[model samples]
Each structure stands twice: as C-alpha cells, then as structure tokens.
Target: MNKSLKHLSRNLLHGVLETLWIWRDERVAARLGWYLAVATNRMPAKYLICRRTPVDVELDAGEDELWSAHREAAKVFEETFGAVRSGELRLRELQRPAKSLMDLKVELVKRMLRHCNFCRWNCRVDRGEGAKRGTCMLDKVSRVSTYFHHLGEELPIRGLRGSGTIFFTSCNMRCGFCQNGDISKDKDNGMVVDPALLAMMMWELRVEGCHNINLVGGEPTIHLHTIVEAISLLGSVQPSRDKLVYLWMMKPDALSWRRLEPAQYLYEGELNAPILWNSNMFMSLETLEILRELVDIWLPDFKFGSNACSIKLARTPWYWETVSRNHKIIYDWGEDIVIRHLVMPNHVECCTKRVLSWISDNMPDVPVNVMDQYHPDCFADPLSPDYDPKYSEIARRPTREEILEAYRFARRLGLVFESISLEKSVFGLRP
Candidate 1:
C-alpha cells in the first residue's frame, strides 16, 4: 500500500472522519481526548498541564478559540480525509511494479548517503559530493540552528500554512532531556553554509508559503552531504513543482541510512512530499533494511514502555528491544507511520500501557502521536554520575489525571491513529 499510500487511502479515511465535523465542539474532543490516551502507551509516565502558570494565563480567550478552531477543523479533516489538491500522488506507477513512493524516497535518501550510519558515532560519514566532518560533530555543511514557520506541528504537519522548521545543530545522542540543550551541547562554529546557500533554504521555504520542509535538529543524520546538497538544490529549482520536502531524523544508525539517496535525485519526476524519519527507534536490522526504501513518514520515538525508562531516557542499552525491533520495521513498512509516545510526568501507565500497548499489538493501523510535550528543559548535568532531575519529585508537573490516564490507554489500544493536545501539555517549568 505504498504507491502514494494507495492513492490517499480513501482520502485519509475521510480526513480523519472529517475532523469531527470541523471540530463542531466537545471541548476539542475532550481536550484532545486527554492527550490521546497516554500517547498510545508503553508508559513513560504521561499527562502534563498540571499548571503553575502560562498556557495563555490558564486557558482563556475562549480556550484560544478552541485551539484555533481545532486547527481549522483539522484542515477540514485533511480535505475530507486524505487531502490532495493537486500535489499529485501517482508517485510512481508508469507500468506499475510497486516501489515508487518517489522511487522509495530517492532510494531512501541515497541509501542513507551511501551507508551513512546516522549517529551513535559510527561516523562512516562520506555524505557524497565530497566529504567533511562526522562523529556527530557535523560538517558536510547543513548547519543553521533554526528556521521557523512551525505552527505547532501535527495534524498532518500543520496544513493550511506553517511546518517548514529546519533547526540542525549537532548531536548523536547526549540526551539528559535535552530540550534543545543550547544547540545540542554547542561547541560553536555551526551555522555554516554554501551548498548553493542550502538550496536557497529550500527555495525559501517554498517562497514562504510553507506547508512542509522540516529537516530538524543537531543530528540530521550527521549532515549527509548537507542533506544531499539541500535536496539537490530544491530538486533543481522546482523542476516541475510538487516537491514539499519534510525530513526530521534523530539517528536510526548505520551512516544515517545513506541519506535516502537525495530524494530520488531531487524529486525524480516530481510529486515528492513526506520522508520524515524523526528517529530514536534505535537501529540495525541493517537500519530497518534502509527504512524500507526511503521512508515517507515514520516519525518514530517510542521512548519506553520501561526498560526502567528506556535505560534512563536515551542512554540506550537496548531500550525495550530496540523500540520493539524498530517498531516492527515500522509496522512492516506501512500505515504512514507516526508513533511518538512522550508523556513523561510520572510515567503514563508504564509508558502508555507497556509501550503503547506494544504499539497497539503491532501497528494497529499506525498513527499514534500522543505526545505531552515534556519540559524541564536544558538539563544541567552538574557533574553527572548518572540521572538527577535535581533530586526528583519526578521533577514536578504532569497531572490532568495523568494526562487522562494516557488518554484512556488510546481507547483501550484499538488506536485509530490518535492525536492529542490540551494546550500542548504546558511544561515550561523553571521556578
């Protein structure tokens, strides 16, 4: 079911059931159904909005106009579940023989930049088109600690505008809870450029209209040749348009799967959007067999259903059998994968019912977003001997009935691709 997600599976299931009639009401689906039932559960503790201030002075202005009218009624429920106003979807079918989510997202970003091994310091960093730095110190240029246009994310990545992120700074896995730990533990001299000015910043985020181009954070597969020279200079200056671009990677290993071979040499025959990796699924199985041929959205990040908080948050040590064998190779490569699971305030029912109920008994129709946006930022180390959050108390915040009991365990794990919010579960702490 790849060929452009089988032509938008009945328009994204009627745009997520017409986003409950463009959010007619029901307190934005019971405040995003208590953060989508513990973010689909594997339990890392969930819920947060235990409030101490902010959240626009505690939900006013008519709950921020029902959270921007449930995000424009969930983009008219993905334009009636599956959206496609002409960004074409026949992403590969000429004589049909399968394999063509734009040639498996440019042969999975040029086979993760020809065997990149993205992060974990395996730095096989060649990044094609002449090499540079690696060991997560990053060099082949992709620097730029920030970019913008991020209307909060999710909802099929901020549709009616915003989602063109960027970030990229430098990290392989230093997490102590790194809420952008000052440019992922900055050593300075980053923001470097020139790869045709990073493909004119992805054609200036598609001429600032932005809807997708999010290649985020200090670990973009340790700079796969500046992300294949800014997606090969925005697919040769919009060779035929239809090239949205949205990558988010966070290390899945094996020379960052050879940077998905420059998205099929820059949007091979056009219509190329969705290649997000946003990892932490931990790797090998030959980097999930090179992300089943150049991903198209596998956001990954199951944090922990408890290997005692995935060996204490990302220090690794096989965190829950490598995020359940790379979430069953991203649910046997399908269901436009999303699963994000971060609710962290007191471990949402053991990280959402034992790791989102073992990813809803093996990818029950993939979609689980369930993030409670943790905070306690910039984790100060203070001579780390191991774990600290300044002498616990579970570092404060996270209770709204423990994020609605991790959103009623994502509807008892039947999980129909749930998403949640309750004002992004606050968490800016620091008093």
Candidate 2:
C-alpha cells in the first residue's frame, strides 16, 4: 500500500480495535460509561450534577467541618449518579441544592489560594494577593496558551470529533525533555483569561462537537481555583437564542432539540461536556478532594518510578510517593481514569518497568496507555542551545526494542494496555 493508504488503513484498524476493546472489557466500560453518556448528551456532566447536590456547611464553617461536609456531599453525589445511571431519575428532575457542592468547592479552592497547596510543591505563597508566585510561576490569573478541538489524543477521549483541549500556561514540574516547553516554561507565553472567558472557551468547544473539555497545561493542579470557577460559570451561562439555534443547527441528530422550546433551552443553561482533568498527578490531597466531585475523568501521567529519577529529570521531589499515593487514592475512589506512562530512552528498567509493575499490582483493571511517543525536546535536545551533557542519557528517542519490551512487560502483568498502545508498525517491531 501507498504511505497514505497505509496510514488510513492503520487508523481504521485502530478504531475498530478500540470499539471492540471497550465492548469486551467490562471494567473499562464501567469506568468510562458516565463520560461517554455526558459526551453524547444522555446524561449531564458531573459538574452540572454537582450543582444539584447540596452541602449543609456555611461558608464560615471551620476547615475540618467543611471537609466533613464535603465528604458527605460526595456520598450524595454518588447516590445521585447511581440513580441517573440506572434510569431511575432524569437529570431535569434533579432539584438545585440550596448550597451546592460546586459552590462550596469554589469557595474552598479560593481559600486555598491564600496559602496555595494546590500541588505537592506547597509553595504556600498567597496567590490571591499577587504579592508572591508559587513554584508553578503562576499567580492569581490563569493564562490560556490555546484552546481547540485536539484530535491527537487517545481513541475514547477524541472520539469521532475531538477532545476539547485548553492548554494552560506554566507547569509545576521542570521536565528537561518536556514536549510543550514553550508554554510550560514561559509564564508570559499566553493570554491571561479569567474564569468567565475560560468558561466560554469550553462552551464554544461543546458547540463545535468536542467530546470532553481536556484541562491541561504545564499542569492544571496549580490553577484549581480558576478551573472550578470556570466550571461553575459554564453551568450557569444561558446562551443567546442565536447560539441555541446554532447549537441545534450544528447537531441535527439531536432528537430532543425539537421537543424543547427555545426559551426552555435558554433557561436550562448547562454545558454537557465531561470535565477531563489532564495533569501530572502531583496535586495535593485537598485539591484532589475538591476535584473528586467535579472531574468526570482523570488523565494522570505516571512519569517516574523512583524519586531519584524524577528529581534529576523533572526537578520534582518525592515522585514515587506522591504519584503513587495520588493514583491509589483516585483508584480507591472508583474514579474513571486512564494512566499514561511515557517510555523514555534508556530509562525503561528504572521507570517504565516500575510504573507498569506498580499499576499491574495495584490498578490492574484500569486502562493504561504505554506511550512510545517520547522524543528529545526542550533542554534534552542536543540541537537546542539549552542542552547540557548531564541530560545526554535521554537525548534521543526510545529504541524499537525498548518500546516492544515495555509493551511486553505490560502484557505480562495483565494490564489493559491494548486500548491506547501504539501499533507495532509504528515502532517497526513484530506483533
């Protein structure tokens, strides 16, 4: 086959395999079923659902009492979700809570800004005052490097349309081989956007038929307040009549669109895109507590196996403990998640093997994407002026043998890796 034909055939095969895997794997289906429902408008997004689940605590409640209320609210959310999933109740039937969990989260996250522990770095700088900046190099405002329908994600995430990706500026970790170094390292690279504008970006992507609102950046954990607030605003903004007409016109297949009056559509203001939290998995437990109620899916990266490697390569301390702890917490919560472990050059034994082993032992049922797309960039690029001999070990792409070995190891551990693993031909390896 010609190169173009070969590429098309490969994509077709991958799509078929992705569908088959989702159908065959009950665990994967159970984990991602809610996300798929929200994407197709069969159910409301978690954030929208959160708006209807009340928290009894007052804004002035003590921190410990507030956390206790938060936990109770999470149980309520679970019960609500169960009803919705089982068709026992419709989303429209859900009464708005007096004080919603989302509202409480918004307030709590804002309070956290006073002594920012959003990420594990614990910079403790008062970001709300703008007097000091955290290790992420971001202050009160969150910057958007770009927002668009990104087609280059995993199968279920992108779907037929694409994943609505919003790239936030600045990251907590300083990975030497960072792919998005320009946006990640430069705090001034993108336009600063408040929660309102950020919400609109999400609205636009939903209108354009994107699957999930993919919140990524150098790292999104640092901008918890902005993200939670944006989600809240997205649920309340009633689009104009013209926009509703446009939305209906764009989605001709929407059967219920005709049944609802234009006025009804205006007042029912809710965005139905699943909140996909794409992050480095270095967030604090407090941040994770808030996100548990909002985020529909977690796209966390398991970057390093050892703290030594993480500290040396990504300038992140306590990599193993932090990432592993976070992963286990999310898993124990029964959250929908897909873990990505990038196969780096010459670090397969120290990183890839260890990460896969941990996942197999702990989260074997969770879908994992053993990525082979790592390439030298940023400071690791020899051609870049920033390159140093000290980072020479990861200055090249992973060998085909290394990629194959990683896949083989994942397979040995019985990990659900086929859903997002690269094709054999991509690595020039035998199947």
Best by TM-score: 2
> What does candidate 1's lDDT look like per residue over 158-274, in tens digits?
533455566677666666666676776683534565555555555455344443456656545555445544553453453122222322221112121122222222233432333
Give TM per candidate.
0.29, 0.87
Residue pairs in collision within model 2: none
- Please identify model 1 stretches exceeding 4 Å from their true place: 1-167, 170-176, 179-182, 185-189, 193-196, 200-214, 218-233, 237-274, 277-335, 342-351, 354-364, 367-382, 385-431
Which 10 successive residues of model 1 have the least lDDT summed? 44-53
The Cα local distance difference test for each model comes to 0.48, 0.81
Model 2: worst 10 consecutive residues (lDDT sum)? 256-265
Error of 1 at 382 (Å): 6.5
How much is 13 displaced in model 1, in angstroms?
37
- Shift of residue 86 alpha carbon in model 1, Å: 13
Please identify model 2 stretches exceeding 4 Å from their true place: 1-27, 238-269, 423-431
lDDT of 2 by residue, 1-431 (tens): 99877766654433212343344556567667777666666667888778899999997887778788988998999999889778898778989878999888988888889899998999899998888888887789888887766778887787645677888999999999999999999988887777877787677666656678999988888889999999999845645666545333433343321122222112245557789999999999999999987888899999898999999999989779999999999999888899999999999999999999999889888889899899999999999999977789999999999999998999899888775665334553322
